[model samples]
Target chain A: MRATTLHGLKDIRFTEVADPVIEQPTDAIVKVIASCICGSDLWNYRGDNDITPGMTMGHESLGVVEEVGSSVSSFRKGDTVIVPFCHCDNTCPNCTFGAQSACVHLGFTVSGQGEYARVTQADGTLYRIDADPAPELLPSLLSLSDVMATGWHAAVAAGVRPGGTAVVVGDGAVGLCGVIAASMMGAEKVVAMSRYADRQKLATAFGATHVVETRGEEGEAEVLELTDGVGADAVLECVGTDQAMRTAFAVARPGSTVGIVGVPHGVQLPVHRMFRKNVGLAGGMAPVRRYLDDLLPLVLDGRINPGLVFDKTLPLAAVAEGYQAMDERTAIKVFLQP
Target chain B: MRATTLHGLKDIRFTEVADPVIEQPTDAIVKVIASCICGSDLWNYRGDNDITPGMTMGHESLGVVEEVGSSVSSFRKGDTVIVPFCHCDNTCPNCTFGAQSACVHLGFTVSGQGEYARVTQADGTLYRIDADPAPELLPSLLSLSDVMATGWHAAVAAGVRPGGTAVVVGDGAVGLCGVIAASMMGAEKVVAMSRYADRQKLATAFGATHVVETRGEEGEAEVLELTDGVGADAVLECVGTDQAMRTAFAVARPGSTVGIVGVPHGVQLPVHRMFRKNVGLAGGMAPVRRYLDDLLPLVLDGRINPGLVFDKTLPLAAVAEGYQAMDERTAIKVFLQP
Candidate 1:
């Protein structure tokens, strides 16, 4: 089987590798149908995150179960499924409370960018699609594995509700999907903060009622001015940088919540500021497994097109090109067909 | 008029001061019937917090309305009212959402240690008691001015639910009161963390189902062990120190909330840990006004004795002795009659 592997900074290789086998009684082997590069992948690609040579490269994918382990009762061979980024037992206290991302038995199953992958804890981690769908629906279904579910997590975590306004920070695919999420969650106004024209356009197409082409203080001021000085009712921090967080806090209304899902780097919260405004902060690694049940149906019915985030698609052999295109900002997200 | 003044570190003085009168159209003058020394007040008295000479030094009080400005329609002479720690217009977006403590027109009214206090934003800041009660009821009613409301805020903010377990950090009056608040809010088990025998007794009396004398990592292990290694459903952070915050986070079950109402001094959140656990952090300065209407009746009807925290009381001229007793840890809370 050919799988994507990371050797060093900026080094992505698609080469023949040993096929994954069901090592554990609860594990299953999946034939990958679709996979994609995530923004978080860039952290390792850019050498900002520790990366070991020949490491498995992706965490999001849609696939067909090729083989089920002895203990896997929930899924069987040939079942179309969405593989959430993290693996959990589902029956653990955390998973039972819908915090599968923080499950006590959580395992990072980041081998999605491959032709074949082994899934651990198959019964709890795999969400079987109800029926077979066309190949064109792969990208959208694959998104439920991580990115789309992550965006929904942000909106829900921020407590987005009817008649409220949501301010989305970041112009990446997750941020764009967040606009869709907030809108679907019944936010009357979805404000997308973007500086790039293409991303801004995508944001608007995804239900952003307003777009702010500013960052930091200016961005906060713009959001405040747009909301008549009361600030947005919910701030979705899809970007985890300090600047994005500051803007999220600044533009949040006094009683609003800021849901942060972006992998935080060097982020220190100003507790006093949040305290003074009575603002609440909640969001972390999203429980993608928990959201798959609700969001997959919308994609299946074509009510939402979260798959639109994939601006470029490539064959498994051209996986390097996919990484290069996203690295240079040529593609918001790149879908890979295995 | 006689008032308590801070001249320097450890220098508390009962000195003659000019009488206060209503200055703003929204102000009213109240002749204080009861006031109390707060843990935060000791910060200035102990020189931990910056203090200006002759600064009027109290924030919690219940008093009789002596005079009102033309715009003060909420109260007139002889009316009894609970003066919350902070003054707010109560019409701002923040106040409208029940976050009066963060009101846009917020004014820190700290003259409760004096014989007379000129209340600003009188209509919103004063919650008038239906009738003047006997001296015995004064302590409990005065508690509505700050401590009781603060504890209630912690419980409410932490999202305590029926059948859930709540862990209260700190043995202070507010923390003991939090035990009561969590119990009243339907928490099946209220765990109070205390080292002092007196505070533990008070905690039990205030509805604490269990008490843990351990601190830091030991305390966290104890809480986790008590809950069958799952941790508590809600953790009330009544202390602002980083260690306390960490313990609060550690004891919180996945998907639980930590409500912090302590005046934070040196606190930096370990966001990654919090995120990974799916633990939420919320709570700040309590919106005392919002809780007054609901809690006052409970106190009045003897359903809750929040005022039992006032273990010592002193005459107007003995304000120095009141401060001394609290400073030396001889009293849990000291009520001052002026």
Candidate 2:
């Protein structure tokens, strides 16, 4: 099997790797149909995260089941499915509560970027579609593995209710998806923070009612002003920088929530300020598997087009170019057809 | 008028001061029927907080309306009322949304420790009962001013639902009130963290199903064990210490909330941990005025006895002794008759 591996900063290569096989009774081997580079993937690509040389790189994928272990009775070969970023037993206390990301017997895979990936806890982590989805639905189905679910989690945790105002704090792929997620969740007004014209267009298309190109305090002021000076009822922090976190808190109403989904780096919360205004601070590693049962239908039926985030697609051999495009902001997301 | 003033660390003096008079058209002067030494007050008394010399001390109060300005239309002279610690012009966006403590035209009164207090924003901050109640009801009515309201805010913010598990993280007056609040809110099991015999007794009396006399990690372990290792669904942080805050987060299940009403002093959140598990961090200054309409009935109907927190009583002249008693932990709360 061919797989993408990181040799060093900005150095990604497609190389021959042993095909994955079911090693446990709970495991299943997925023949990758489609995969994508995530913004989180850039953390290691830019040398920001500790990247071990030759480590396989991807966590999101849509695929077909090649084989299942003896104990895996829910899925069979040729079945199309969405594989979540994290694998969980699903019967654990955390998984039972719909927080599969924090599952006790957690299994993670970087093999997602490869042609054949072994999926542990197949019955729990993989969601089978009633039938093989159309090729055009692949991007949206793949997104259900991570980004879309994460974006939806941000809106859900922020309590974006019907007729409420919602604010998205980033313009990345996930941020654009957040605009769509908030809209789907019945937020009357979705505000997107974006300075880039291209991303702003996508944000608007994804259902952003307003767009503010300003930054820092000015941006916060604009969001607050747009919400009648009371701030948005729910603010989604899609960018985890300290400034984004601060703006999320600053632009939320007293009883509202700031749901942060981006993996935080050096984000120290303004605890006193959040406390004083009673703003709820929530969201993290989203339980993508838990949300698939609900969000996949929207994707399958074309009620939502989250796949619009994939601005570029390439063959498995062009993996480096895909990463380069993402790093240089040439694409919101880059799909790799395996 | 005589008022309790902080002279220095551990030095409280009952000194003569100018009588409070209406300074705003929205103001009302109240002859204080009762005031109590709060656990928060001890911060200044113990030198943990900056002790401004001659600063009038006390925030909680229940009293009779002595005078009202022309604009004060809610009450008549001699009407008994509960004055929330934070005086807010309830029409502000924050107050209208049920966060009176963060009101735009916020007024804080420390004059409750005095013989008479000029309540600002009288129509918004004072809740008038139907009529003067029996002397036996004074203690409970007086508690509605702060501690009881604060405790109730903690439970409400934490989303304490019927048949859920609740954990209270402090053994002070407000913490004890939290146990009662959690029980009143329909939590099936209430766990109280206490190291003292007297406080433990009060906690059980207040409907604590279990009591754990440990601190920090050990205490969190006890709570997790009590809840079958799933942790509590709602954890109330009544103590502002960093340890208490950490334990509150540690003992809460995923998708749960840690409601902290403690006046935080140098508290830094473990943002990464909290984010990973999706534990919501919420609550701050209780909007007591907003809760008065709901909780007052509970007190009036003898459904709750939050006033049992006040174990000692003293005249205005013995204000210094009241502070001393609280400082020495000789009394959970000290009631002062002005």
Candidate 3:
């Protein structure tokens, strides 16, 4: 089998590797049909993160069940499925409370530009898709694995009820999808806080009722003006910077929640301000396992097209350039067809 | 009117001040029968706060309505009432949300310590007792104005549902009262985190099933063990300190809330950890206006006795000593009989 390997800064190569075989009774081998470059992937590709040598680089995909171990009961060969970024037992106390990412035995695969995923704990991790989705829908369906779920989680944690006002703080694909998620969840007013004109257009198309171009205090002020000074009922912080966290606090109404889905690079909350206002906070990595049951349907029915976030496409060899396109803000997301 | 005027650190003195008069159409002048020292007041007495000199030092009391302005319709002269710390119109958007503390046009009672509160926005701020409370019941009923309500708000905001486990992270009057409030709100397992024996006794009597002498990581471990490694379903943070805030977070389960009613001094939140677990936070000054309807009944019905928090009592002229006693930890709360 061939796999993508991360060697050093901007250095990724396709190399011959031993095919993955099930070592655990609960494990299964997934033949990857499609995968993609994530904004988070750039963290490792830029050598800005703790990247181990010869690391497999991704966790987003749609695939077929090439094989399953003896103990597997719910799936078989030739079954198509979506692999959530994190693996969990789904019966742990954490999973019961909708926090699958914090499961006692969480697992992940680094076979980014891969031909297969050796997913452990298969019964609880993979979600079978309907009737082998068309090849054109492969890229879109695969997104449900990570980014879509992340965006949906942000909206869900923010309590974006129907007619509720929601504000998304980041312009990344996840943020864009969060805007769509908020709308799908019945939010009547969806505001996307983005400075980029291109992303802004996509955000409006995704159902954002308004777009504010200001940053920091100005942005918060614009949100207030749009929401009639009451502030948003829910604000999603998709960027984990300290500044983004503060902006989330500044734009939420008293008693409203600031859903923060961004993986923190470094964040120190404004407790003094948040505590005084009774502003609540709820967000984390999308518990895609908890949301996929509902999100998958909207995708199948065409009620939502979260795939719009994938603004670029490339072959397996262009993975490095794919990372750069998103890193340079030239593309929202990039798909890799192996 | 004679009020306890704070001049400097530990420098409280009784000084003659002009009695309050009707300042607004809804304002009512109430002659205070009794008042108590709050934990937050100690902040100023210890010179740890930025309160100005000559400021009257109390926000808790039961009083008699001595005079009513033109628009005061809920209470007549001679009525006995409890004045919430915050004065609200009961018609603002904040009031509708049951967040009277954040009320628009909220009026402050500057001379809060002495008799004669020029209680503005009387309708929402003053709760008239069906009958005048006896001098003997004043102290206990007086606590209903602030600390008890504050504790109730903390528990309620933390989402203390029936049969839930609630951990209170403070053992002051408010913390102990939170135990009573949690039980009242249907919490089955209330854990009072306090080291002081006297406070522990009070907490136990108030229905705390467990009393753990916890102060940090060890305290968190104790709580997690108590809940079988799941942590408490609700956490009431009644202390305004960084350590207290962190403890509240550490002791709550995923999908639960950490209600903070403490006047935050300098609490830096662990946002990353909180978001990852889907924990929610909501708090502030007690929205006493929202709880008085139910809490006052518990007080009147004798189901709750919050006044027991006051271990010492003094006449109005000796309020300076009362403040000193509370500051020195010689009193849980000082009851000043006017």
DockQ of each: 0.78, 0.77, 0.61
**Higher lDDT: candidate 2 or 3?**
2
Ranking by DockQ: 1, 2, 3
TM-score on alpha carbons, each prediction: 0.98, 0.98, 0.95
**Lowest-sum lDDT 10-residue window in model 3 chain A:** A269-278
Tens-place lDDT digits, model 3, residues A1-338: 78778898878777777788898998889998888988888778887689888888788888889899998889899898898888877888888878888777678766847887788788888899875688777766888999889999888888899888999999998999999899888899999999999899999999999999999999989998998788888999898888898898899887688888888777887777776677878777777888888988888888888888888998877777787788788998998888
Q: Return the DockQ of model 3.
A: 0.61
Expressed as tens digits, the lDDT of each residue in B65-86 for candidate 1 is: 9999998887899998899988
Q: Residue A70 error for model 3, in Å?
A: 4.5
TM-score of chain A of each: 0.98, 0.97, 0.96
In model 1, state the lDDT of residue A261: 90
User: Considering DockQ, which of the candidate structures 1 and 3 is the better prediction for this target?
Assistant: 1
TM-score of model 3's chain A: 0.96
Task: Give the per-residue lDDT digits (tens) of candidate 2, residues A227-263.
Answer: 9999999999998889999999999999788998999
- For model 1, the superposed segments whose C-alpha errors exceed 4 Å read none
If ranked by lDDT, best first, what sequence of candidates would result? 2, 1, 3
- Window of ten residues with lowest summed lDDT in model 2 chain B: B127-136
